[model samples]
Each structure stands twice: as C-alpha cells, then as structure tokens.
Target chain A: MSHRSFVWLCLLPLAAVTVAFFLLPMARLVVTGAEGPQGLAGYLAILTEPRYRATLLNTVLLATATTIVTLIVATVAGMFLQRHRFPGRAILIAMLTFPLAFPGVVVGFMIILLAGRQGLIGDFSNRVLGEKLVFAYSIYGLFLGYLYFSIPRVILTIMAAVQKLDTGLEEAARSLGASPWAVQRDVVLPALAPAFVASGAIAFATAMGAFGTAFTLATNIDVLPMLIYTEFTLAANFSVSAALSVGLGIITWLILALARSFSGSAVAAAG
Target chain B: MSAQAGHGASVRIEACGKTFADGTRALEPATLEIARGETLVLLGPSGCGKTTMLRIIAGLELPDAGGRVLFDGKDMTAVPIERRNVGMVFQSYALFPNMSVSDNIGYGLKIRGVPEKERAARVAELVALTNISGLENRRIDQLSGGQRQRVALARAVAIRPGILLLDEPLTALDAALRDRLRGELNRLLRALGITTIYVTHDQSEAMELGDRVVVMQKGKIAQIGTPREIYFTPNSRFVAEFIGAANIVEAAIENGHLVLPGGRQPIDGDANISAAVAMIRPETIRVLAAESAPLSGVIDSVSFIGDRQRLVVSGVSNRSLTVDAPNTVRAKSGERIGLSISPDAVRLLPPER
Candidate 1:
C-alpha cells in the first residue's frame, strides 16, 4: 500500500470510534427526546413547570456566579504564576491544575470533608456560632464543589495565554505616561480579553452541566443535574429524563457557540 | 516641522553606568554629550552596552552609580520616561496592531491631552511628511515593512519631542529598502533638526546616518568622533579593527624611523612610540608587479568582488596582508607580487593590551 493510503487506513478505527461513541449517542438522544411519547409537549413541560423551571434558572445563575468568581481567582493566580518568581511556584501551579486529574466524585467528597456539616469549617461554624452551617448541602455548596474543577481549567488556559502575551505592550504603555493601573486597564486587560472570554465560557458550561459533584452534594438542594438523575433512575420516567437531558445539552451547546464566537473574534483582532 | 523647534535640547551624561541585579555590568561609567540638533549614533557590536546607553537616556533604565543625565542644562536624573518629553522608535516598530496608522501616530499627542482637532491635523501633517498620507486608515498588519517604519517614525515625532531615540530602526528592512529609507531619514531628520540618538551595530549605517559616532566596547565607550575621524584616524586598535577591514602591522620606531618585518618599508607617522601597530586601510594598499616591486610577496589567493578584487598576500616572514585592487588587476596563485601603502594613510595605535 502507498504511504498516504496506509495513513488513512490507520485513522479509520479512531474516526469510527468517535462517531459510534459520541455522535451516535447524541444523535440518538436527540431523536428519542423528540419522538418518544408526548414528544415536544414533554420538553415544553420541563421548561414550563416551576420546579423544573427553577432548576434551569438556578443552573444558569449558579454557573454565572461560578464563572465570575472562578475567573477572578484564576486570572489573579494565572498572572501571578506567569510573572512573579517566588519559591514553590512550580508546586503551586501543579496544585492548581491537579484537580483536573481527579474524578468529580473524589473532588465532591473532598469538598464535603472540608465544608460539610460535620466537616472542618462546618464543625467550626456550628460550635463557634451555635448554628449548623449547610455549606456542603446548599446551592453555594454546589458552586464550591464545581469550583474545584472549574477554577483549575480556567487557570491553566489563562496562564498559557498570559505566558504567550507580548510583554512589550505593557512596557510600551508604561513608557507612554501610563501608571500601573492605566497600563493594566488599557494594555494588559485588552490583551487578555479574548482568553478571559474563552475561559469564562468553558467555566460556565462546566458548572452548568456538572453531574457527579451536584449529585454527591444534593442533600438540602435539588439542582438541574440531580433532578435529571432522579427522573431517570428514581421516577422511572425516560421521557422526562431525556427531555431534561436535551435541555441541558442545548444550554451547553449555546455556551460552546458563544466560546467559539469569542475565540474567533479574538483571533481576528490579534491578526 | 520647523527645524528651529528641535534645537536647544542638548543632553549631557556624566559618569553613567549600569550593573544589573545579576551582577552583569551592562554599561560602565561613561560620560558624553549630545549637542543641540546633533545626530549621534551609538555604534557597537552586540552586548557592548550601546543599547543600554540609549535606554538610560530614554529613562527606561537607571544608572547604578556616578551618573547624572541632564537635558538642556537641567538635571533630569530622577525624571521618568514619560515625563522626559523624549520620543523613541523601537527596533520592531511596535506599532499598535489594532490601531489605524492615524491613531498610532496620534497616540502620544492624545496621551498628552492635545485637543482632538489639533491631534487630527498633526497626524495628517505627519502622515504627509512620511509620504504615507494615503495609508492613514490602514492597520499596521496591512502595511509593508517600509510603510510600518514610516508610521513608527511619524508616531515618534508626532509629539514634537525635544529628543528622538531610534533603536536599529532600519535593521528589519531589506538592503534596497534600508538604503532608500536611510536617505529619506537623513533628509527628514535634518529638516526637523530633532536631537536624535540612533543606535546600530552596522558600521556603514553609523557612518551614513550619524553626524558623530560613539563606538562602545564591553560596557564602555571605545571612541567618539566623526565618521571620517573614526574611519581615517581611529583612536584605538579596537576602533580601527571594528570600523572596517584594516591591515594592522606591528612595527617599531628605531632611530626615528619605522621598521617592519619581511624587508617592508616604513610608513611615516608620529615616531614617539618605541613599538606600535600601523593601521592601514585596505584601499590604501597598492599592488605592483614583482619586477618593479619594493617589497615582494606571493599572491596566496584572489577574490573578485564586483568593483574591486581582494588579494591575500603572504610575505617571506609568513605575515599575511589583504590588499584591494581594481577588478582589472588580475594575478595568478603563487605569483610573486609587491605591496606598498601610502605613508600618509598609516595611523599608529598603541600596542595591544
């Protein structure tokens, strides 16, 4: 066989695996959600019912809140990691990105140990303030849990971006009568805007679609992911669960679309 | 754009030096001056601290000790770069890619709070001055190298700064573009008469662009003089060797006459020193046929350049010398030849340290 033909043959299995495992499943899910039983009515019901509607709204709100907080923390950490030379900086960076290697269940359990009612901060709060602090069982708890995974992704992405940025722009701005704040505002921030948008979109999508962490921490709260799980496994309502899955898929797709648009424009502007 | 406005901004450096935090002495204590409206080129090899001196003058770097920078008789040692009222063009041009040509040119004026209409008018004037009036609305990426260089020049001069600093501005261009822009640069700079400090390592560039040249060595000034003075009469052995291809022959002064090896004749210069190196330029060496020769040598090799041929001659003492002859002067390998140099063209430098 020719070299080019051999290369094409080598890629056939990987391409077939991707189509079978990913695209085919998604295509089947979409078809099932649209054609099964009550069909579009079932999807509409999930959007209109207050219980499910609140789940959607809460997902968006929590995701946005998580994105903002994660962005701030990650941006600061990323810039510090990129610029400053301090002791143990490599260790710090490793620790920041270490969460990505762990399963979501493990991260959720770690958060529980740190902030659950019987956990470290929860026990301290209860004994010190004479109240049981539900830090691991509330919506805020879910956010904190998702943060373990989201913040790291944001930091790694933004740090790579910051490292690759042309440092001359900042020097040029400073030489042109700009104070530190002015330089950050006029030069540094504008240069980092595209990376910020891209990482924020990823963080939002990850937080919204989080299932394992949400399921592990769903004690006093019922998030969209937990509700979808309960409809699938506990209530035995395949139609409702599929509809919820489709809804979550659409939200994630929207976020991915926004990310693509932002990244595209960023490249255009840089060019 | 009047020439009178750029005068009277003389810069004086007193014992300026820079030692980086890592203990590398980037620049040594050096004193110099740039008279009003004078174009000074800091010429040196890489890592010789010429760029460091330019940065110090631009206020981007602070000398470690024993230095004071004065502008127009005012001590500006503590002044920051932005407040120094000096303009700079970087080696990479550093034009804001996101900005149009007009906006890039108007940046400094805008930062200085020039009125909007005035900024516009001044940018228009500079665009025309740079011969880039039609490219005002183009982004930096859309412009060619020569065009970007013009934009960078226009941007540096838009504020009517008292001093202008250029860091290897033409090093990025091709030979043809560099030559063309250098001529234009000379005319424009002379017309504006800005107190300009151009930094470059290219000897030809320094000779062409500078009214005076400051040749620097490792963290110190080797010599400072006009192009003619530097080329024709270098102050030190390093200057002579660096500025051009020079034939340095070690000679001794015995009884008020120079003596060289291989039965070569003495060249006339000050005979004060007991021993020194005679610096002779390549063009000053004349080649003669062996029969009518004063000092005979074998032609080791010949290289035919476009206008002239370069011949490598080895004497009986194995002393090799390079001589430039007209392209019409042809010689075969291992052929006997005679080399002679004019006495007036020889300059003596102190023995190598």
Candidate 2:
C-alpha cells in the first residue's frame, strides 16, 4: 500500500469510534433539540422560559463564585505549603488532596453528614441556638460540595507553580527596598497568573456541568443539571433536556475560552 | 551622575562568621572596612565564602552572635535588606518578566512612592546611562541576554542605594561578552563611584574592576590587597596561585637564593630560611639563547597565543617551568633554551596553611 493509504488505515479505528460514539450522538442530540413543539425555537426557549432561564443563571453564578473563592483560598494555602517545611506537612497536603479521589455523590453525602437535618450541625445548633439548622438540601449545600472537590484540583496546580518560583527574584526585590507584602503583590502574584487562570477555569467548568452532587441534594436546588435531569427523566421532555444540555456545554466552554484569552494560558485543568 | 544618584556610604563588618543549621561553616570570622566610593572585589574559586560575606553586608544573611555590620559610624546590623537601602544585582538578573523594561527599572522608585513624572524621569535617565534607551517599552522576556543584563543594572541603580552589591554579574555571559562587560562595568563603577562590593571567581575581572581584591579560600580570606600588590607580593601560596598563572617551585633557601634541582634561583626573601616556596609569574621568565644564561632546559611544548608564546620547559626545576615568551620569538618544542628571571621578580611565599 502507499504511505498515505497506510496512514489512513492506521486512523480508521479512531475515526470509526469518533463517528459512532461522538459525532452521531452529538448530531442526534442537536436534531432532537429542534423536534419539540416550538421547533427550532426550542433552543431559544432556554433563554425565554423564565424557569429554565433562572436555573441557567443560578448555575453560572454558583460556578463563578466557586471559581473565585477557590482561587483565593488555594493560592494562599499553596503558597504556604510550598514555602515552608515542617513536621507532618506532607501528611497535611495528602489529607487536603484526599478529596480528589472522591465522586461528587460522596462529597454531597459528606456535606449532609456535616450540616443535614438530624446531623451534627443540626444537633449542635439545636442546643446552642434553640433551632435545628439544616442546609443540606439547599443550594448552599451543593456549593460546599463543589468547593470541597475543586480545592484539591486548584491547590495542586498553584503548589506546582509556587515551587518553580525563583527565590532570587524575591531577594532582588527585597534588596531594591520592597517590603514582604510588596514582593508578594508585585512579583510573586504576577508570576503565578497563568496557574490561577488554568485552575480557575477547571473549577468553574466543573461546577457548571456537575450533576451528581446536585442530584443527591436536589430537593430544593434548581441548578441547570438538576433541572435537566427532572425534565428528561421525570417529565419525559427529551427535546428540552437535549437543548438544555447543549446550552450548558456551550456556556461552560465559552466562559473557559474567555478566561483563557484573558490570562493567555489560563486554561481548563483535568479532572 | 553619581551626585544625582547619591553618595556612597562607608561600611564596616566586624568579626562576622556564619554557620548554617547543619553546623557547616560557610564563612569564618572576618573583619573588613570599605571606604566611601571604593570598589572592593571578593575573588576566589567556587564555595570560597565570598558570596556569604557579601550577603552579610547586604543584610540578606545575619552573622553569628556578637557580629555586627555598620554603615557610616551607625550600627545597622539589625536592619533588614528592605530597609538597608542596598542595591543588588544577581547573577540571574532576576528582572520582573511581567513588567516592561521601564516598569522594571522604575519599580523601586515606585515602591518608595516617588511621583509618576519624577519616576519616569529617573527611569529615563537610567535607561540612557545603561545604554538601553530604546528598550524601555519592551517586555523583559522579549529582551536579549545582554539587554536583560543592562536592564538589571539599571533597575538596581534606579533606587540610588547607599551601597551596591553585585554577585557574579557577568558570569552568566559568554567569554567574549564577559570580557567586554568587565571593561564597561569598570568604567561605569568609576563614573558612579558607589561603595560597590563585587563577587566573582574570575581573577581578571577582579583585577580590572576592583580598587582592592580579597582573595578567599575554603571559608576564610587568604589575603586582601590591591590588585598589583596581590599579584606581585602574595602573602600565601593560595593567593599567588589564585590571582594569576604562577610557577611555584619548592626549594631550600641559602643566602637569599633558592637552590633548585637544576639551577640556583635568586629570590627576594630572608637569607636564613631552611626551606621555602617561591612564585615566578610566567611572563617574568625570559627565554634566552642557550649560551647566555646558566639555567637551561629543553622546551617540551610551545603554544602560540597571538600576543605571547607559552613554552613549557622541563629540567629547569624538579617540576616543569612555564615561560611566556613574546610572540615574535622563534621557538619550537624540543629546542634547548636558557631561562633568565630577575631576583626582584621572584616572590617568596609562606608555605600552605
């Protein structure tokens, strides 16, 4: 066979898998989205329907908030962990990253054990404030669960970045009369900008598309993933659910791209 | 230009010693004085404690207990580097990559809360002074190596520090660029007249740039003197070998003459010493016609080095003696040549510590 034909032969299996599993399914989903009563306007129904619009806004806001908070907390923790050496420091870092191995359902379950009705927080608050404080079925519970898993992913990237920082740069800044705060603000933070963008994008996109935690605590939460699940599985609204899935993926990807352009290398991190 | 930058401060380091946490000695107890506007260089091989001493003076590292650093009659040992007002240029340049060249140069001034217009004027002045006038708006990553070096120097001087500490500033460049920068740095230092402490392993750099050189070995100072004094009248064997190429011959001294295996060499030293070590710089030894001098040897090798020809002559001493003959001399390997060295040019040194 010719070289070009041989190369094509090598790519045949990969092309078959992509076409069968990915391209065909994606095309079917797109077509199914337009097959609703509103026709192609089913895509526009995502923006016009008040209930669906609210769920989309809620999901976006939660993801953005989680990303911003994750970056702040992780940057501080990562800097401290990378710069200092002490007994049990390695063990502490291992414990912080232990959540990386957890599924979102487990994270939500753990949050329930901490703050659910008839749980530890409810019992403690009942005694202290004479009330059973429960938030396990609310959006706040889902927020807490997202933060739990997002921290480990963001912290590792920030720590790796902090480890590669040049100590000479800090010393040079100090010799030029920069105080410690000034050194951190002007020198160290600017150098870590790329890491922040990359990790923050991952945290944001994960929060936007996450469904397991939302499903576990979906009693009161109206996040887009939970709304899509109800429409498809409970209400049997396949076309609307398909349209919503496409909308969720596009919005998450668009935000990630915007972030990447802003920070140049701010990109989505792996799971 | 130096008046605009500010006056240099007199610095004194008293009995400074450094011991790391692992109990290894990085620098031994030493005392030194640096006058205002004087350039002092610490020259030695790697791990010679030269950088440690510079760090102590710069307040980057504290000395052992009871040691103190003073500036202009004031004890400044307790001050930190940020408050000491010392300018430092590292071997890595360490320019801020996130900022433009002008921003990097103006950073210290901005930290001091200098007004925007005044800061720009000062940065402009430094850019011109360092010959990087057109690169102000460029990013640090976009700059060439030479340009980065100039930017580092300009940034360090922008703050008008009382003393300047440079750690192997040109050691990162190629040999040709290093030599060129050596002359340029000397002229710049002379023009600035700052109390500058320069650390380098290259002896030629020390000779060209320093008003005085401190020769160090291990964790202690071997000798401290002017470049000429250190080169010509080294107090110890280490100083003599570290400064320049010298043929060290071990011999017994009798009546101010060193008795070698193949020749009796006249030296300027005590006449009563039973045994001694003497140093003869290669350039000081003259290769002569075989009949003119008593000391004779067969040239093992002749290397033409453009400006001078170096001949390794055996049998003149127990070890081979190196002679730097002028390039014009027609000499080849395996030829017999007489070697002549003046008594004044031969320096007797104390045996190794």
Q: Report lDDT per candidate.
A: 0.83, 0.90
Compared with the true structure, model 1 gives a TM-score of 0.89
Across B1-353, the per-residue lDDT of candidate 1 in tens digits comes to 22344563899999999999889999989999998888999999999999999999988899877799999999988998878888788888877766788988988887888999999999999999999978989988899999999998998888888888999999999999999999999899888888999999999989988989999999889999999999999978899989989887776667544565545565675576787677888898788877675567888999989899898888722368888998888787799887776777778776656
lDDT of 1 at B41: 96
List ranges where model 1 is wrong by over 4 Å: A1-12, A35-37, A113-115, A118-134, A219-222, A265-271, B1-8, B262-270, B287-298, B316-318, B326-340
Best model number under DockQ: 2
Tens-digit lDDT track for model 2 on A1-271?
A: 9999999999999999999999999999999999999999999999999999999999999999999999999999999999999999999999999999988889888889988987799999999999999998898888889999999999999999999999889998999889999999999999999898899999998999888887777645889888888899989999999999999988988888888998876475454
* DockQ category of candidate 1: acceptable
Highest-scoring model, TM-score: 2
**Residues A1-271 of candidate 1: C-alpha lDDT, one tens digit per residue:** 9999999999999999999999998888777677657877888977788999998888888988998999999998899889998899999889889988877678788888888867888788888998867678678778888887888988987898899877756656555666777767766777788888888887887788778787777633667778878887888877788888989878777776777786675321100
Place model 2 in a CAPRI quality band.
high
Assess candidate 1 and give its lDDT.
0.83
Query: What is the C-alpha DockQ of each candidate?
Result: 0.37, 0.84
